[model samples]
Target: MGTAERINSSQRTLPYVEIMDSTLRDGEQTNGVSFLPHEKLMVARMLLHDVNVDRIEVASARVSEGEKEAVRMICRYADQIGKLDRVEVLGFVDGHLSVDWITDCGGKVINLLAKGSLKHCTHQLQKTPENHIADIKETVEYATSKGLSVNLYLEDWSNGMKDSPEYVYQLMDELSSVSTIKRFMLPDTLGVMNPLQVIEYFRKMIKRYPDIHFDFHAHNDYDLAVSNSLAAVLSGAKGLHVTVNGLGERCGNAPMASVQAILKDQFHAKTGIVEDQLNGISRLVEGYSGIAVAPNQPIVGENVFTQVAGVHADGDTKDKLYYNELIPERFGRKREYALGKNSGKANIAKNLEELGLELTPEQTKRVTQRITELGDKKEIVTQEDLPYIVSDVLKHDAPEDKVKLISYVVSTAYGLKPGANIKVEINGQQYDGSAVGDGQYDAFVKALRYIYKKYLNRTFPILANYQVSIPPGGRTDALVQTVITWHYNDGLLRTRGLDADQTEAAIKATFKMLNIVESNL
Candidate 1:
């Protein structure tokens, strides 16, 4: 179990590593986070069916009645899908209590938690290692008698290896003989192991119990969960415990997406995960967990696939010189070229291609200059904003807007509905319309719709989606950017506007949408 042996072990073709996602159990432990029964059910379904993770630890037994109900719901769905065996619950070494709770909720697997470190066993539980082992054995025996398969979690196993190797060895030695324990999950419970230490310790465990399945559970106190996970696999660990979005108590656990990617790409290890579903499930968990995934998080992050440097975009255009094995498409995302001060012609061209627009070299230079100006002012620009940028920069050659908002006034009072009065000129004909609505924007849109429907007898486009974004720093004067999507004819159209007022930005975007629709007509 030395470095040379670890290196040699890694050189050999690695075995398929089973992935056990503990998002429901470990991830739910995040501060200020709680998942209701339905939320838990949805996340569990996505992990098992869509993401295709090998197993899911849904809950810790006896936590609460609500948790028990969530487990029941997940178990029912999993059973219907023939995935009941893949759902597991964390059970304590409390004999029949944890086991009966799980069986009553229809769970088939119990991940039995046992003390691994001498300090935890000696201080926390106030029991000798022998007493703790007996308790675990009793629990495992009871769980087996109840027809539930068992896995053992050597809690704080990393510290046990570092501080008391004999204690960990003795526990493993005693438990390895139990034919019913399907796996031994070793946790870096405090997020304290470096990669080299992980390799050293995991190799020792693998060397001692070569036949037993060892799953590495990593915490990210040192931001080394992914690295330590790789090291564990290199040291011949057979499985890994991860959580969606890396959610867990304190820092977090090894993220499912990152661990899976590294295991497959770096180690050439096989897993059952559906890579394309990784991003989707990350987003799903983010919504339900209310823990935002960092935009720069690997594989499933928002900005990981974005080409921010113009040189990278230039390289990408020429035979994909900047491409790597971590292609965005592998995770159901497409590469995006960001428009900013750093954007070069290549970046502009890449975004243009996606928008199905072609620009002359001179036009591209002007648009690039305009985007750079916006970037310098700390404004955000999206691909959907490109058309408007192009029109503004080349206004001399651009045709006049077919639909124009001459004037608008919106008012709201505490005792009454908001109202809007608008004057619009379409095709050289001016019209005035007024309407009251639930909000100022709604009233404005209704007024505009009244002009199109009553005065012109024309079908107004349906507003489909509206999103507003403000740059960071939270300054009151910070510019707001609004992007609106409209359903017009057989296709969808997007328009963007930027202004100091959010309502004004939305109105500008609405005007842009009207002009685009009118031009098409």
Candidate 2:
């Protein structure tokens, strides 16, 4: 067939693209990432119900008993909701084993994996093209007989298109007769293709068989998956394969978030994805996979929506000059201005605006300077830490700590719970308290609580979280930075301290919190 003959005569200006999220199967190929059966089911539900992805490949055929159970669980739920056709399983070109495995697990679709590259077909399977075609024919026949719909995966299709176009065309020519095949999936198995190659090759395939539904699966070996996917779409490809957090083997597949964003913004193609649920699903996958995404990963990363430069925040205030189409609100996230040495007055003002606090111009300048100084010490200033810093910098005569820790002795022995004895002063009144706890810091907090409740008649703030970190290449005498978050008055407060001992560092942070609470009171 020639290019002119293969072009779709009724093609529209912009194609309606389908999104197939393989977060469960290909995403599980990510190193050190595995979801439990229930976790897989939960992810499947969210991807289908919340994210509204058109289809989900749940698992590979006959991997393990655990994988089977996970697949079966997801299939059961998908079946109950009348969406069993939306769930698919990856299968080999084995005659009936893959088909039977999928059928037994309640899966209705089998994405049969076949070699697209002549090298993979010849070396990986050590079979000639003729024999490989025979195997795939038998597999398709068996799958169809078992009442399963089928999609064909041309694994390593990019290399195939480059090095063995004849072999690729030959395989497609043979499989074109398989009328039950729903779609043909082409994978850049080695992550080697660039956008130009994708466009060139995809156009060739589309021109050859414009009638066949084609899906492009990209890998991020060169950080080009998103670009390549867009190129494929521009070349008239019909579908995309993606994973949440870009989880897959090696460099992973194209990230669902990035692909969706580009398809809508650049290509003007439409997908069924609900943009608001993208971040929620990304976080869920990250937690289950135990893989922390880079802070700068597009769309769903932690700092992608953060304005770290003062100029950027300043532009944002003046009619969103620094903003783009990828607004944080579109993904159910709020923009943040980082507080650090790089932060400018505009950045501080932005944070203050979020906190609903008004400060004089001088006060804002002093606070910004103090934040920069703290940042110079490599300290992280969270929004929760701003009020305390402001009070400390503004008050010339530091407010007397109404509740003061006069003395404390904490000890941890080999077989006993840690114990603390503490003396505190409140309004010139003295109180001594002792307590035992799971740790020395816990005991100290308990003793302090005793004084607050019994002697001072006040409510102590609840410790919500505590984190301790030593600098890189930690040494025995290295300073430990302890940041403690406290809950008070329906809000959160954070304070930090540095010392050689972790417990002492926490205590110093607690002392800072004490003064903060006192100043506020």
Error of 1 at 496 (Å): 3.7
Q: Per-residue alpha-carbon lDDT of model 2 for 361-389, expressed as tens digits?
A: 99999999999998888778877578768
Give one clash count per candidate, in the order shown: 0, 0
TM-score of 1: 0.84
Model 2, residue 151: distance off in Å is 0.3
TM-score of each: 0.84, 0.80
C-alpha local distance difference test of each model: 0.90, 0.89
Point out where model 2 deviates above 4 Å.
1-12, 396-521
Worst 10 residues of 2 by lDDT: 3-12
- lDDT for 285 in candidate 1 is 89
Q: What would the per-residue lDDT of candidate 1 be over residues 70-162, giving only the tens digit for each residue?
A: 999999999999999999999998868899999999999999999999999999999999999889888888899999999999999999999
Regions of candidate 1 where Cα sits further than 4 Å from its true position = 1-12, 397-468, 472-474, 477-480, 483-521
